[model samples]
Target: MKVELYDTTLRDGAQSEYISFTVKDKLRIAKKLDELGIHYIEGGFPGSNPKDAEFFSRVKEIEFDNSKIVAFGSTRHAKVKAEDDMNLRSLVDSGTDYVTIFGKSWDMHVRDALKILPEENLSMITDSIEYLREHGIKVFFDAEHFFDGYINNKEYAMKTLRAAEEAKASCLILCDTNGGALPFNILEVLNEVKGKIKTALGIHAHNDSDAGVANSVIAVRAGATQVHGTINGYGERCGNANLCSVIPNIKLKLHINCISDNQLKKLTEVSKLVAELANMSHLHNMPYVGRSAFAHKGGVHIDAVLKNPLTYEHIKPELVGNERRFLISDLSGKSNILAKAKELGLKLGKGSPEVKVILDQLKEMEKQGYQFEGAEASFELLLMRTLGLVKKFFVLDGFRIIVDTHYEELTSEGTIKVRVGNRYEHTAAEGNGPVNALDNALRKALEKFYPSLRDVYLTDYKVRVLDTTEGTGAKVRVLIESTDGKDSWSTVGVSENIIEASLKALIDSIEYKLHRTRGQ
Candidate 1:
């Protein structure tokens, strides 16, 4: 049987700390999930809140090409009939064809958390499933904490599943609620329950002990037919099993085509997009879709890769919407430099004198905490400047900035003795901040010579305390990312003064833009 993949990114993912998706974010993420071709999407608990109810109501308008939106909730309360449970009524009213409900599978959870007898808990599970089925909604019963529950009370856990079977649940999902169960435990429990139940089983894992993916793999091998996860592993605590990791592992490694080939091609894009929507920086070391997933830094590795790509790379980066990067770092050797030079349309023979000079500059800058791996524009500008290809567009004049408690002021700012092709222009401008003032002043000074600078604008400014309580009283590192309506680039600067760092990065951004424009 074909194993199915169900995504719960928007619902369970919101359970992740510091993550709250706006309606716009939810819609965008839902569209991407649809594009990913997941078999099911557990949106949210409709009866739990107004936002989820609104999401389900609006989600009906979104036509998914490959996935079905599922409504997730819990079973009826103790002493309450399933037909009369408020939670069950909400599920039916959500208008979703599929409804997933979790019950007390563990004896401890039943006796302690729910404070009810195991028999009563089993009845609640059975009655809830049958009620949903009676209302024409397919029921997916989550045996929460299944592995641990099975280990503690095997007979009770299996009996609870039997209850689900009697009620005719469409699928019984085995959940690692605490997210601490290891694969061996999963395989053991799955081994016992694989053929014992008449219903198709599913695996819903979390990543507390970092075994979510491993447990998922083990369960699938043991005959589970469905995998539950969130994109980029977004969920409570350490997060859920990353569908980005699970899909490729199952599809490419296990020869199980869990998602369509077309969806597979857009996997990396969708993964990054979801990360963007979540406002979380994509983990560079994350397996297939990360920025550093296919990066090569060592010299020997680059040489071998250039000789034969398979020498260093296990699979083509393009297979997952990722690209290989030749990083320039201390470990980078001659092969790396030559490859980078070749990419920049520059010729560098093995052990060239110019290569030594450039390497010396790079090493010295790195010692000062410059990271060229993420600042390719700065690196390229440094290379060109060292090669005597850079032209000085203008010179900076004296400028003064003053700041007080409530108000700040910048004055006596204008270019003087500035040479631009045997002509000079003096100008001044005020802005919101000193760095902005400096930027405005510099642009005003150079606008006549480089009129294209008029179109440039700063979009992002990031500051880092490099040593975090060390290095010149927390040496400030600044990265300013800019765009000229057509292209974007980033530049970095580090200094003891935060303003100075910001100024330097701003200058680099402008100069880099100017150089590229001039060259073009």
Candidate 2:
């Protein structure tokens, strides 16, 4: 079966906390979505904000081959004509051939929100859809709060959909705006509506009940032709249905055609790109595209997957542009080490002395609170050292940090000394914190020897207490993620002193970059 994918990332997704996209960001994202084979891209509500209005005006310059640009808005006001409604007028002026207008379906919303009679609400829906159709725009009517409306007053909800159908709406999208409806409820309501409405059916689901994807799938099974959602499930509150999960489920599990298999391979990249652009940390546990989605840690699961990946993985990770990871942990076995070695292009046979040695070292380091799962760079460095393939780029001589408080103002300063090749360098710098000061001083000293170090910078730093029972002096583990704009890597360190831990991780980060660059 053919199903249409409608993405509202620019519209509903912008309502998420801390998700503010510039006009350039929106246009870039829309193009990316189009490249991924989405059928429709809801640019934004053009009348709601100046940025969205400007986005609609600027989006016309780019050519989208597969996806159609859609302007989103609400129906005409009950008190005014459709032509006079500013929101409705903006949709027409957006210059898009497609428009989505949501209308109240529940009688309670009509009386309380719109402050109009139920009949007037029906008239508004019909008039707005017909007016947009008259302007040579294909109309998709979103029945907002549809599940709740159907439960409260089935007759009025049916009437609202009938009004849209009578106005020649291309699709009637049933929206679960509150996102509290269950899959069974969605199936039941959509089945009843499918029998009543002659127009094409669509679904717009939210994740408030954590069943948005399930509900959307059920609606599709119940004959919804178009599925509306956002990439990475980004939206207000819990979020909208996650297209990353929904699209694959509909195509692979349901045996339906959504996008080509080649397009599916770009899923992970697209998901991460959206999260990066949104300035949010990607969820490691997210279903298909997460970093840890196919990670194997336990010995039993690792051995089984090594023998045959189908024993543990539901689908091949490569199908979604992700790779299976054999995480090095205390629970890992020799098979885990072999798999990781194979991935790093190391030749470690079964029952090799090096395998046991590496396993023992990993267990000891993990006991010391080194988490190799999140610090793959550290793990790779450790593997290279064990295989005698690593060379030290520099040696740390010593470091000192000093904090001074004068009158209520506080300042942190760091000094470092290091030997690069046959020469020695010393540097000092101040920063907002002890770690930052150390980072600045160390980078300042290293840049003299390695010019490429100027392009490298720390992107993220996290510290975790290994043993709280040891009180304030407990061992702390530091993980630092660094990037050189083109690529990124993670390194880890552990020590009783927080500053020492940070310094170790920082040193590893710089050494990793140098090693990769120099082909060491």
Worst 10 residues of 2 by lDDT: 511-520
Model 2: per-residue Cα lDDT over 1-520, one tens digit each: 6799999999999899889998988999998898888999999999999999999999999998889999999999878999999999999999999999999998899999888888889999999998999999999999999999999999999999999999999999999999999999999999899998999999999999999999999999999999999999999999999999998899889978798898899889999889988989889999999999999999889889988999999999998889899898888898888888999888999868988888899999988889988898989999989988888889999999999996898898999999978999999999988999999999999998888999999999999999999999999999999999999999999999999999999998998888889822
| lDDT tens digits by residue: candidate 1, 195-214 | 79889999999999999988
Highest-scoring model, lDDT = 2
Per-residue lDDT, model 1, residue 287, is 88
Q: How well does candidate 1 score on lDDT at residue 468?
A: 79
Reference-based lDDT, residue 356, model 1: 85
State residue 388's C-alpha deviation in candidate 1, in Å: 4.4
**Cα-based TM-score, every candidate:** 0.91, 0.97
